[model samples]
Target: MHYESPVREPLVIGDKTYHDITRDVARPIETTAPKMWWIAFSIAMAMFLWGVGGILWTIANGIGSWGLNKTVGWAWDITNFVWWVGIGHAGTLISAVLLLFRQKWRMSINRSAEAMTIFSVIQAALFPVIHMGRVWLAYFVLPIPNQFGSLWVNFNSPLLWDVFALSTYLSVSTVFWYVGLIPDFAMIRDRAVNPIQKHIYKILSFGWGGKVKHWQRFEEVSLVLAGLATPLVLSVHTIVSMDFATSVIPGWHTTIFPPYFVAGAIFSGFAMVQTLLIITRKLFNLEDYITIQHIEMMNIIIMLTGSIVGVAYITELFIAWYSGVEYEQYAFLNRATGPYWWAYWSMMTCNVFSPQFMWSKKLRTNLIFTFIISIVVNIGMWFERFVIIVTSLHRDYLPSSWSMFSPTAVDIAFFLGSIGFFFVLFLLYARTFPVIAQAELKTILKSSGEKHKKHHSDDNHGHH
Candidate 1:
């Protein structure tokens, strides 16, 4: 009797086999970095350095350097923080939620998505630190014994909850991402030509060998981590929303913020993923692995989440009018027709209206349209945060304190710099890391490719 490996369609395109999957993923890391990667990296580094200068200038000149006033204490800084946090949520969704659902398509994109999550969160973490005016004494927010006195941090504060939630999320996501990379790192280590490359990957892989027991443990550990990460996805954003929902401000105090924010997070997260992957697939020549089918499915998610977010916007308006509270009613009214109405409309147009384009199959699958809308979605999400934070606070109870908030050059610099910082990390990651999960892709190749189907058909005909 002869033993035969199961024959099926390839998951990887370009007629790739399992060995090819390993070779393709490990190629960037094993070989010299691409010229395009370096060009993008240089641009990103310049932006990052520009942002660093802005941070240093702000610290030296004090918070007064930014356009923040007493009436609008929280402006671009908090808005960017929320935006980055929301962007990070999709990564957790792709890694944890999709994993639990046993969605095989996620395997191609989840590795990079998880990396995006970690890097975006790092960018988000910078905001609260910089916004603190006295960032040097930032440890005071932690529940530690202080030298000044036993002044305990406020346990009841949502801001403190943010501290806990963001920290836990970053830590778990790092562990989750590193764990997923171990097998791929081992693949790279095995094929490495340079002694330094081999040693680095070996250390990173934790000596992973292709033993049956090792495979079993890897799957078990992945499942356990996914289980742990699932609830954090919901909780992290909910806690962030509580920073507003728990407030007494008319627009901020709402019962619907948790689910609304989570939907928006996934919406924005998927858009960012699409934006990154579309560029990635084209740049690295991995169309077979990251297919149009994957892009279409993600667009569908964007449309669904965008609709949910739109409905949430309407629900907030209805609830405000129904409550008959002058403050709440005026808050919603101000958002639509007041001084900052432009921001509100921008959110509506980009988020609610733009995603509707995806309902058309041709548009959803069109790479250019998907990329454009992905960017639009992020822009809209940023406006959503701005409208929520600044618009709500700009005109409060006392009309005497009414004032318009605008971002300074420093504010704009910091935000743009954060973008540079995020891409800088991501570009480096793309060059050095396995962007696709080789081990996971191998498992699905039989079911994914056209060649496998042809092989199966041939085998069945021969048996007949």
Candidate 2:
């Protein structure tokens, strides 16, 4: 077993040097794609449209058009909401968490992960809005000093807290992402020959030259943002858990939910990143920059978090049984032996059992298997949330009040449509952005901090 060191050393380049990203590694970044990618992109686009049509259908008809019944009022919408939100976690972790740790490899993939955060957040924000059913009056969730009265927003409600927390988290993440893009924008801006492209990038670069002092301060601000975002990532997911844990429901009342949810978020988020990266590294011809080493490192994380998530599941069941709380025990048992057995077992197989394969390097390192496992992990995660939200609520207390709810056609379409929505945006992003962050890539190329390498930035960079 190799103990991979985490230290990074800076690399210095003379002011006159020109970077040749194409020749930086064994493989060129411009990949020759098979026709299938176009087909896939098209299909994803169609899915996004169909998903939108479903949303529109719900809007026209009503929120009651879907399968959410009295008992399971928060079925698919909340499930999808948490799932997408969880998926957003890994991006912040990759960009913010690793940056604080000074993990240089993060540079090569951080931009894509940041884009994932932005896109996933977009996908996530849709659920709360659409789940409101009236869609148009969904603004009711927003707090405005109303003509009805001076009654303020509910400071007491977690859902209201969600309104505040999610918006703040999303806004901060977006700004941090855009700020990081400035230097990279300058690179592309300087390289662009097309008049229109040059104009767009010129405004974006904000007259950033490669000035040494500017680079120094840029580094400082980037680090500061990284520090802020790291905690925000944890806090955001923890708040999402509060939406559940703060409740009185048997399974929902556990103290474990926050960390468990956070771990699950990172677990699923990384799996999503892996899914995109596997295709991205190949499609963008970024194998050299992304490297097998990069994949292996991520696999290690997937394994660790996948295992952590598995433990959370088991721990939940165990605590329920151990606490001697009839309600809690029954909540879990109902999940396994009750009507939702299929969903429960599916979650276990996808999240718990599949990741066990990664314990073996041969399995984790296999490109196809890794990708398939990543997909399975995501599926398991979605089901885990579904089982948690729906199963627990579907038959809460009092058997007389117990009921079942299956999603309507609208629910199915909207759910699948969001998948399309996420991918469609992602595909377009890949085509337009560097996909691999050039500036961050330079940071990675710097020496191992263990080796204590000297560093330098170009004089042609940001303004003095």
lDDT values, one for every candidate: 0.91, 0.81
Residue 455 of model 1, lDDT score: 67
Score candidate 2 by lDDT: 0.81
Per-model C-alpha RMSD:
2.7, 6.1
Clash count of each predicted structure: 4, 13
| Candidate 2 residue spans exceeding 4 A from truth | 1-18, 22-34, 446-464
lDDT of 1 by residue, 1-464 (tens): 21123452244566677888887787767778778888988999999999998899999999999999999989899999999999999998998999999887798999999999999999999999998988998898889998878789999999999999999999999999998999899888898888998899889999988899989998999999999999998999999999999999999999999999999999999999999999888878778889888899999999999999999999999999999999999999999999999999999999999999999999998999999999999999999999999999999999999999878889888998999999999998988899998898888777665567566667878998
Q: Candidate 2 at 451: error in angstroms?
A: 15
Q: How would you encode candidate 2's per-residue C-alpha lDDT over 1-464 as one tens digit per residue?
A: 22223332222222212275523321221243357568879999999999999999998998888898777889898999999999999999999999899776787788889899888988888998987767777667778866678767778888888877788878988888887888777777777767897888789878889799998998888899889999899988898999999999988999999899999999999999999999987875666566666777788898898888889989999999999999999999999999999999999999988888988888877889989988999999999999989998999888888998798889988989999999998887776566766775655343432222322222223335
Q: Residue 408: error of model 1 in Å?
A: 1.1
The lDDT leader among the candidates is 1
* Model 2: worst 10 consecutive residues (lDDT sum): 9-18
Worst 10 residues of 1 by lDDT: 1-10
Off by over 4 Å in 1: 1-11, 457-464
TM-score, structure 2 vs. true: 0.90
Model 1 residue 294 distance off true place after TM-score fit, in angstroms: 0.6
